[model samples]
Structure formats: C-alpha cells, structure tokens
Target chain A: MKTLVVDYQAGNLRSVETALRHIGASHEITDDPVRLARAERIIFPGVGDAAHAMRLLAERGIDRVMRERHAAGIPILGICLGCQIVLEATEEGGAACLGLVPGTARRFPSECGKVPHMGWNTVRSREDHWLFRGVPAESSFYFVHSYYPAPESEEDAIAWCDYGIEFAAAVERGSLVATQFHPEKSGEAGLQLLRTFVEAG
Target chain B: MLQKRVIVCLDVRDGKTTKGVRFEGNVDIGDPVEMARACYEQGVDELVFYDITASAEGRGIMIEVVRRVAEQIFIPFCVGGGIATTDDMRAVLLAGAEKVSVNSQAVRNPRIIREGARRFGNQAIVLGMDALADRRMPSGYRVVINGGRVQTDLDALEWAREAERLGAGEIVVNSIDADGTRDGYELEVTRVIATGVGVPVVASGGAGVPGHLVEVFTRGAADAALVASMVHYGEYTVDDIKKVVADAGIPVRRQGARPEAGPV
Candidate 1:
C-alpha cells in the first residue's frame, strides 16, 4: 500500500517511516504537500508541541492539504501528538488544529496522577473498527502523552486507556483512525493495528 | 485503573549498550538494537536509551540507533543524551524516537524545555534529572547534571517544579547515590520529586529486587519504574516485576493477547 508519512517537523518521521517499511508497506516521508496530497493513505506521527507543530504545518501549507485528504475519503492515522493535532483545538498552547474530528484536546487532569501518562497502557476497544482487526479487547499499547483528545461522541472512540481517568486512546470516524499510543512502538499488538490499516487502504 | 509500568533502560556509548555498578565499572552488554528487540519480546512496557557519551561527543548518535530499533520493534522507546536545543530534539524525534529526554541541557537552558514541550507537546518531552542526596540542601536532594559528573545548586524539588512549569511531560529522577547500587530506589528523593511535580515521575537507579519497584510505586508515588542492570543481566524479567506489582494489589498490564479482566 502507498502511505504518506507526514513530515511537519514535529513527528517521529524516520521511526514511523521505518515501522511502515518493517510492515512491508510502501511509504514516503515528506514535508511537501503535493506528495502528501497524492498518497493513497496518510500517517501523521507527531512528537512535538501542538502549537509549534501546527505552526510548521501552516508554514508548509500542509494543514489545508491534510483537510483535503481527509475529506477525500483517504485513510489517515495520527499517532501521539499527531492525534492531538487532528482535534479542533488543544489547551496545550491554545493551538488550532484541523477539525477533521469533532473534539478538543485537553491536558490530562493534574490530579490524575502525573501530567504525561507515559509507558504501556491497556486500551479497551469500544467498537468494532477495522484498525483493531486481530487485536483483542483490552490489549495494551505503549503510550507517552499528557494531553488526550476528548471526542464529542463516545461512538467515535474505538478504544480507551485509563490514566487518572478513562480517556479516548483511539478514535475512528469513517476512514480516519487516530491513536494516542505509538503503534510503531506498541510491540506486536501495535504491528497488528498497522497491518490492519495498511490492508484497509 | 492505571497499570504499573515495567521499563528497561539501555545505557548506550559509542553505539554499544553498557551497564555499570555505582556509575563505575562499566561493561559492554551487547548491540543496542539486539538488546532492545529482546526486551520487546520479553514484553517490556517501555525502553529508555541514555546516550552516556552525548555530551562529550558534542552530538547524538542514538537517533540512528533509535531508527534501527524502531524498524525492528514495535514498542515505545525514550532517547536521552546530548540534547541541548530544539534542533537536537527535532533531530531525534525525526529519527523515530518517541520521547526526547533533556537533563543538563534543561538545567542550562530552561527555555529548551518550554520550547520543546510547546513544539512537540508536553507528552513528547521528558526531563531526566540525576539527583544526589545532600543534607544541607533545602529539599535534602541536589540536582546533578552532565551525566552525574557535575553538581548544580538547584534543589531536586525546585528543579522538578520548574521542569513541569516549562511543560516537561515527565520527570525521571535518577539518584546518583543509589544508581547501580541495586539496594533499592532512593524513596526519599523520588518521593520529594514525585510529590512536587505534576508530571509522571520515573524512579531510576538502585533497583535490585522486584519489590523495589513496589516501594517506588507506593512510597515514592512514582507512576513508572526504570531499571537497567537487573534486567540487562537477566536477574529479573519485566514480567516478574509486573507480577510482583500485581500481587501487591497495584495494577499492571500483563502480556499476551488476553484482555485485562478488570476495568482499566
């Protein structure tokens, strides 16, 4: 499958690129909006700040291209910070994001133990989504984030992971699937999730 | 319910993984890529790669290693070393590192922490502080940097608060006194930082037994526990540590395809 790994200066692009290669998928890592626009599937893997990342996207004009890709029915997967940027806005830096998914990204309550809920977390699948094919319910995926997207609809959530409180760990609406955990770093279970995404494409 | 985390740390120098005792007597373990893959097969919850040679070399090679390991394994990996600027953090992240850890650099330039968190989001930035117990200090622990080679006047608690304020998502408190001692974690120091910071605290150093992890979680109030020597030498498996934590009534995510029987 042809996949475009977004390069917005905020993603773990090489790692995401390497993971896609390991999964035997043909992928290109590019900051060029034109290349991204032509891909059959897109993967947005972000690791830096939402505001700065969004600013970089805006500078490159990739944000508009991403909105176009999402509207075109192309399967897109956002990992970690990438998932947060897909929301309407984030409290992290009051950054605006592509409102492809109806949600607002907010910091995990400080009372909820720690700020960034790092390490492995169990995600309970809320619905039958193709991205979760071959993955069992309550499968643990590696997560490293302090902010989680609070989707407007519970039906949009495909999986949930509990930190201080339960929050959306994975979201799916139409052809768009995004995860707060790094599928590239979630071990075999994560590989299954990526394989499902590639197959769906 | 939050599951207890089992972390395996790899100290990398010149592209090889090494482990030492009391921060001395360094010995080469093996290839970092191979060791990391093995840890993944053993179901390690997270992996930490500390570039012990970063500051001295004035550059970071762990990024390439992170790329290699990311290609081979599907597990969260944290990279720490000579990360001093936004460009450095961006380089590592672009190389495939899930989290970039800042230590001496964060101390020297607190803005680096703020800028990193602002650009990468707080979750992708990790502040690694190596602390040493000092009775005369206000917080009773002092922050050490440059791979524990230099001591700073900053108190552990104060530095932790500043790190969190600057948008550090996680804080890994490494006790230089207990590092590689294998007696246990420095609960006193870890507790002070964990209680002071709003971010997740990862207690590193002095992890000799499985129960030490429990002590870190309960007494230290740390969200995750990190170990290197014990797991690297095969003294204890990640699964063993999880069982010990689970048996202690603390929740831990168990390996395999089965779902967690209880509410997560």
Candidate 2:
C-alpha cells in the first residue's frame, strides 16, 4: 500500500520516510492535498510550532483534505506536533488547530523535571491497540517537545507518559492514531511499533 | 525512573571512523556505519558522530554517510562538526539525524544556537564545547575551539550558561586536557558546567575504565557520558560498560530487554 506522509513544510518527514522504508512500506512525501485525497494511509508527522504548522497545512488546503479523509474512515497517524495540530487548539501560540481530535495542547509547567523533556522516557499502553500489539508496555520512546496534548475525553487515550504531569502519549479513536514521541528515531521496540502499523494496512 | 545514558562517540574523517590522541596522529579505525551497527547491537543508548575533517566541501559526502547510518541503525544519533547555520542543521536533520551539535560555529555566531533551537526545537540542538584547564579564567577553565588549536577568552562555565540562555537543549562537555589520556574525565570542569547549565550535560573525553563512567555519572554530576577509546580499543562493548554502570547502582535500560516500564 502506498502511504501519504503529509508534508506541510514542517516535521521530520525524512526520518518518518526512513522508518517506513525500513518496514518495507512504500510512501510518498508530499504537500499536495489532491495527492493525499487518494492516500491509502496518511501520516501527519510533524515537529516545530503547532500554530505555524497549521497555517502551512491550511495554505496547501491539506487540512480540509485531511478532515474529509478522516470523515471517510481513512487511517491517519500523527506524531508530536502533528498530533498537537490535530487537536482543537494549542497553547503554544494561543492558536486554533484542525479540531480532528477534541483536545488542547498545553505547555508542560516549568515545575516539570525539564521543559522540553528531551530524551528517552517510558510510555504505557492504555489499551490493546493494533499499533502497539507487540510493543511492550513501558517501552521508552524518544520525546522532544515542551507542549503536550490533553485529549478532551479520557477514552481517546491509548498510551500515556509523564514529564511534569500525566499527558497523552498516544491517542486513538476509530481510524485515528497519534503519538507524541518520534517512533522513527526510537530504537528496536519503536521499529516494532512502526512495523505493526505498516503491516496493519 | 529516567535511566542514565551511555553514548558511544565515533570520530569520522573522510567517512572512516578514526581514533587520535589529543586530536593528532589519527589512525583509521573502521567503517563508521558498520561500527555504529555493532555498537547498537551491543546496547548503546545513543551515538554521536563527529566529522573530524572540518571542510564545507566534504559535508555533502558526510551527509550521505549520516543517511546510510540512520538507515541502518534504529537508535537516535547526533551529528557534530562543521554545523554553522540553521540551514546546516536542517540539512543534517533532514538527512535523518536526530540532533545536530555545533562547536566552533556556535562560538563564532552564538545566535546559531537560538536560531537552531527556534527552527528545530531545543532538543534537536546540542552545544559541543571543548574546554582546557586554565587557572587564569574565573571558572578555572577556558573554552577551546578549532579542534583545540585555539583557546578563547570565553570561560567554560560562563559560555555554558550563555548557551543555555540562548536555548541549547544539551551540552557535550569535552576537556582537552584529559582528552585521550584515558585517565578519566575532568570531574572539576565537568561538574562546574553540568551543575551550572539547566540543560542535560554529556561528559566527553578521557574515559579509561568502567570506574570512570561511575565517577562521572556520580561525583561528576553528568547526565550522560560519551565514550570513545575504551570502547574503540575493543576492551569493552557497550553492554559491558552499561553492565558495569548498572552494577554500581545506577539505572540503565538494557537494549531490547523487557520494555515494560512502570510508573516509578
């Protein structure tokens, strides 16, 4: 299956593409919403500021296409800032987001061990999601952001990690699956997680 | 619990992993990508690749080398040497590197740290500092650049504080005095910077034995330690070093071990 890695001029698309290739999956990195319209699976991988990313996505009309795709039951995976933009809003720029997932991204309080919480940390599985089938609970994934998304409903949370406070590490609802960590840069267990998602298609 | 990290550093010149004493009389070690794979399999937490041949012309080729290494290894790795601007950081990050380290360039243009951190987020940028023992300096250590060929007026402690203020996510502290001596880390200098900086500090250079790792992680107050000679000389594997570190009552995640991490 050909996967569309939506590139709105933000995020680590190259690393995500490398991860997909490592799993023997074919993917196209593009910013065109028209091409994404035919996507079998769309991965909204991101890094950088959520407000700016949302603007870039809107400029290319990709946000609309993404919403349409989600409504059609197509699988979409979001990572870090990609996951944040899917929420209703983010505190980074006091900006509104795609609203695909009902939540808001808030910055981790300075009282947290570290603001960005950079490096490896454990993520706990909240449910038996296909994307984490073989990924053992407590598996450490790479995280590099200060702001984190808090899903409006607890039921949407599939995995969680803590820095200053307990925040959504991975959220799932119907066909949407998102993680705040960079699975592409994560190690062997992370590869297993990518393989599970790629093979699920 | 956040586990202490054991990072293996590879000094690459012309795409070949090389080892040198005090940054001179370098000898080719092996293929960097292959060596990186071997180290990862042995349970290294991270890898830092430094392109020793600081040339703009060779960077294009070095990026390909980084791409190949990223393709082969699953763990996060950092690229340092010759990174001068935000665009240079982008070029390497886009090539699949997880972090970019700036040393000489960061000194010449301190804004590069803020620019890189702003463009790529703080965690993606690392400040590589080469420091030498100096009694004349207020901090008792001076910042050295250009591969230890030139000493600067900047104090090691003060520069580290400035780097953090400008938005560096991590600091890799290398002591030119203890470098390659394998006697151990410069605990005095390392403790000064590690305690002074808000960001995580990685201790680099002068690691000889498992005991040194313990010393740096404990008394040195380092968040992580970068090893080169001890592992490069084939006296120890990444696992052996980690086992030694863990045996000393420090927490470390064994590579590919049970991933179940409980809320501790």
TM-score of each candidate's B chain against the true B chain = 0.91, 0.93
Residue A126, model 1: lDDT of 62
Please give, as one word, the docking class of candidate 2.
Answer: acceptable
| Candidate DockQ scores, in order | 0.55, 0.47
Best by DockQ: 1
What is the per-residue lDDT of model 1 for residues A1-201, given as tens digits with 9 covering 90 to 100?
A: 678888877754666667778879888888999898887899888876788889999999999999998889999999988888888999988988989889889898778866567777788886666778898778888777768989988888888888878899988777788999988877778888888888785
Q: lDDT of model 1 at residue B18? A: 80
Stretches off by above 4 angstroms in model 1 are A49-64, A88-96, B21-24, B54-64, B84-91, B105-121, B145-151, B256-264
lDDT, candidate 1, B106-146, per-residue tens: 99899999998877777778999999999988999999987
The candidate 2 chain A region of ten consecutive residues with least summed lDDT is: A110-119
User: A1-201, model 2: which lDDT tens digit per residue?
Assistant: 878888888857777887788888888889887899888788888888778888898899988998899888888888888888888999999999988889899888877764667777788887677788887778778777888889999998888887758888988767888889888878887888877776675
CAPRI docking class of candidate 1: medium
lDDT of every model, 2 decimals? 0.82, 0.85
lDDT of 2 at B218: 93
TM-score of 1: 0.87
Model 2, span B1-264: residue lDDT tens: 456788999989988888875546888988898888787777677899998876766788789889998898787899998887798899889888889999989999999999998888888899999999999999999999997999889999999999999989999999999987889999999899988877889999899998899999899988889998787867877778878898999867676432222110
